[model samples]
Target: MHLNHSPNQNIILEHSSIHLAIKREDLIHPFISGNKFRKLKYNIQQAQSDNAFRLLTFGGAFSNHIAAVAYAGKEHGFKTIGVIRGEEIGFKPELNPTLLFAKSCGMQFKFVTREIYRTKTESNFMDSLKTEFGDFFLIPEGGTNDLAVKGCEEILEESDLIYDYMCCAVGTGGTISGLINASKAHQKILGFPALKGDFLQEDIRKFANQDNWELVTDYNFGGYGKIKPELVTFMNSFKDRHKIPLDPIYTGKMMFGIFDLIEKGFFPKDSKILAIHTGGLQGVSGVNDLLKRKNQPLINL
Candidate 1:
């Protein structure tokens, strides 16, 4: 259960007057990195306190949550089950790096269709899972829960109060919600949603207690898990310049947004900004595999 401090590294820009720093939450751990670590920390403890040994969760094919839960459960001596979307992957798990890694970590998989995966939170679906897995601890998809939010609230430290704007990639909204709740009154939290839609405003409002936040919707790059060649180019160039790697799904999009916003003069002069690097680097390999198959430019590892 050892955790490391996430350092805030300053990003030097030659032209832009906006001061930017990124919280290296990605460096928190190998498998349980970034917001995954924060989201799971308290959930695991609650499961242990409840004396629930087996842990069951949900995710897509290249899900960081599934990988983190698999490794964390193995590390904590809990049996893990991943109810994955896309039943086709169940028949050929060896082809997917994320699934193979989870399997190597001793996670059992139950594959279902996208339609079935949507009902994952329903009582009937959960009762069926309980019947099959026998009283396992259930963690919601993307690991967004009250306890998870509590853990994510620990991401910001006292030193973070110096920043005027805090930025983070929004998935299920837990990470930004925690930031919003933990941030100072003067600090504004900006969320870059991975998925398309205004639904996140409602979702984020469910957990976020503060009103000092805005969603930058322009950089989703054609929805979740979808990317353009320009984005791949930017990510590679960003890594080459800053010595920081950005995952395609979450952090990459947020970083791209931040840089673009800077170029557009969105931030006022001398406005201190902090962007959270919520890790999903493990999925880069899987994404590269997809890109290779699609004959598109791949993200450099």
Candidate 2:
């Protein structure tokens, strides 16, 4: 266990015993902690390799990936742009949490409608953005690109594979897809889909160029970022038991699905599974606030 705890109760549980041979030093940047570094590493390199002076990507208001890209791009001294999913309203200087942070950190943002935002890979849009930004590298939404796949593929190489299966919450599916492709061990890539699913497995193969992955969409708790009372209690007990801290959006639902599938006899009793702690612990802080507002109670399973 190698994690620094804050004075507040926000705990990040890490396993030092799961050491690897090909460890990358830049995996632990100040805000680029956890899978963010792995997920963004090759994307940044690709931007530079393509003679791109600017890097443009897409995300929602409070996306960690967007934040990371902004910070990392600025750190690497590349001009960064964020294609925000929703329209910006009012004459507000400070927008949402992510918008404010991205702008403050020197990442320029362009707001777009949901319909236009959907056509992210269309040639017309790409050409227009290229013209606007002046020769920029295009990273997909959530930084889920081939380069990001290659980068996250390195995460599997960095992990010790003593388990029969690998599980992680899938937002873009790039993370699990990359790991599935990079893995040599005969392990199942159990992915908990964070979206309404939206054919993420197809998107995975499109982005990752691989088919060796499974999508567990049963435990999304209705939709992305939505949480139920059972989920909160389950998260608490999981912390009490394995001491595994989880976000309601990603890892929490992942663990919920994993345990439910286990109870349903999805895996053999002897199967040794290693759940990938693809960190989104910061997301849980906001979840706590939500639970408090809704007067959600904490009870055990």
Candidate 3:
């Protein structure tokens, strides 16, 4: 799981307007399966370099990074701790299967309320967390720092594919920044925010630090972790169409938004674009459980 290989072309929809490289090797493994693997390589090495026994990080209830961090931490002989956002509702934080797997792989949990969790980026919070955890390496949430972006920037190297404009879902701005920075200086990047549109570009700009990145807030599907019937229909049809499973959280919305933009004549007539499928398969089980637990019908399409 920690190894690297050359890209296998999964040419799904190749028209005159687009040359999409849905890499076949990317689709066969666990979702958090590809990009996260690359992102964590440096972090794990950093921990070992520092001779740290534990790796600490932050994420939401359904964070793919937390799962990957745990999996990778265990793999590399480092203990993992997740300072998760939101308070534990029950003793377990309900322990969703995604988190449960992380925990099973030897991840510890430190739950905090949303209010306090917002300040996780503060030096003080990290200082105190370091004091508490005692000599552990702390990875920022979404792994969006210079290192993660530098690592993610290499995703393009595995492919001989190129795009005039690249489309990706912006969650923490790391992947978009990394990919945009990695691509040629002239290439354009369109980022669709998974969360609300408010100040999203401003948020992205903090990571991008350049002019080539554009934020498209049109197709968030009613905000982060929230979905609609049309989205489910689109996901199912897209799965059938491209045979790629897109969860509701990130990649799915970006794909939907890209099509909507194309419909509105946003891009040029023959724009070659690539849509990144950042893996997040662990999210599906929890989202489906969320629907069922709320008695909400999930398959409306």
Candidate 4:
């Protein structure tokens, strides 16, 4: 799909003498959008090549991966099984938009306790799932694997070489690893992790061939799925100003870091920047619910 590489006209960029453009990967597809689409592209092909009838993956109550894989599996004629993180969600799927959407797409769920879900990468867990669900293609939590990284490398095109910096939100590190591999020699890739940690650097290094990348670890609000009122306010104001909706889990935090860096003079003057908007807009409804319960300001969707 041909996506628009639109310039962001935020006044902050003007004041900082930085030129920023957003690669609208979010608009790639309504259901299978952004990095999820990239990450799943080759994995889906591989699953078909292996003659798999089912695609089994992992996720939490409000996971974007769960929703994407479910839709992708349904659209491509493969049955999907979501190994959901919380056992409670299995009985109350209707309460969460992400899970509800996946269920609507014909995904079966195997909700596990947080403890069992922690053993998801172990051989014993794999054996148990195999005994229960039969032969299936396994996509790891967040769908990060060799094939997924290979698919993500296609995210940056020749036209993107003009940019000096490539920026994106980091989740399981798959997207940034692909960006790091595909990045131009002169371009420095900066990742704003949505979760707190230095562990992602090592994970990203496993797939990344180039060393032109660094992770900005300060923007993760608290941790995964954790958000603050300031972040909510920024997201709403940013959408009102830029006409772009950013999900709090990833892109919103990345953009917040980018704008903060620009304001703090982190980038050299006259630098050209391209931010990859990896879509997770589907999780916004779920996030708003949490905000409502807390009596905090909700993100203006």
| Residue 192 alpha-carbon offset, candidate 3, angstroms | 1.0
lDDT of each: 0.94, 0.69, 0.74, 0.90
* Local accuracy of candidate 4 as per-residue lDDT tens digits, 1-301: 2334433333345545798888888988888878999999999999989999999999999999999999999988999999999898778889999988999999999999999999999999999999999999999999999999998898888888989999999999999999999997999999999888789988998999999999998899998888999998899998998889999999999999998998888999899999999999999999899889999999998
lDDT of candidate model 2 versus the reference: 0.69
Residue-pair clashes per candidate: 0, 0, 0, 0
Candidate with the greatest lDDT versus the true structure: 1
lDDT of 1 at 113: 94
lDDT of 1 by residue, 41-149 (tens): 9999999999988999999999999999999999999999999999888889999999999999999999999899999888999899988889898898999999999
Please identify model 3 stretches exceeding 4 Å from their true place. 4-16, 23-32, 158-161, 197-203, 206-210, 299-301
TM-score of 2: 0.80
- Estimate, for each residue in 1-301, the C-alpha lDDT of model 3 and write its tens digit: 4454535344354343645554332453453465676577677777788889998999988888888888888777888999988786326765587778888889988989999999998989888888888878878887766677777777675343456777778888878887776777667888888888567666556656567878888888778888787887888888887667787888779878877776677888776777777777777887887788887656322
RMSD in Å for all candidates: 0.7, 6.0, 2.9, 1.9
TM-score per prediction, in order, is 0.99, 0.80, 0.88, 0.96
Query: 144 in model 3: Cα distance from truth in Å?
Result: 1.2
lDDT order, best first, reads: 1, 4, 3, 2
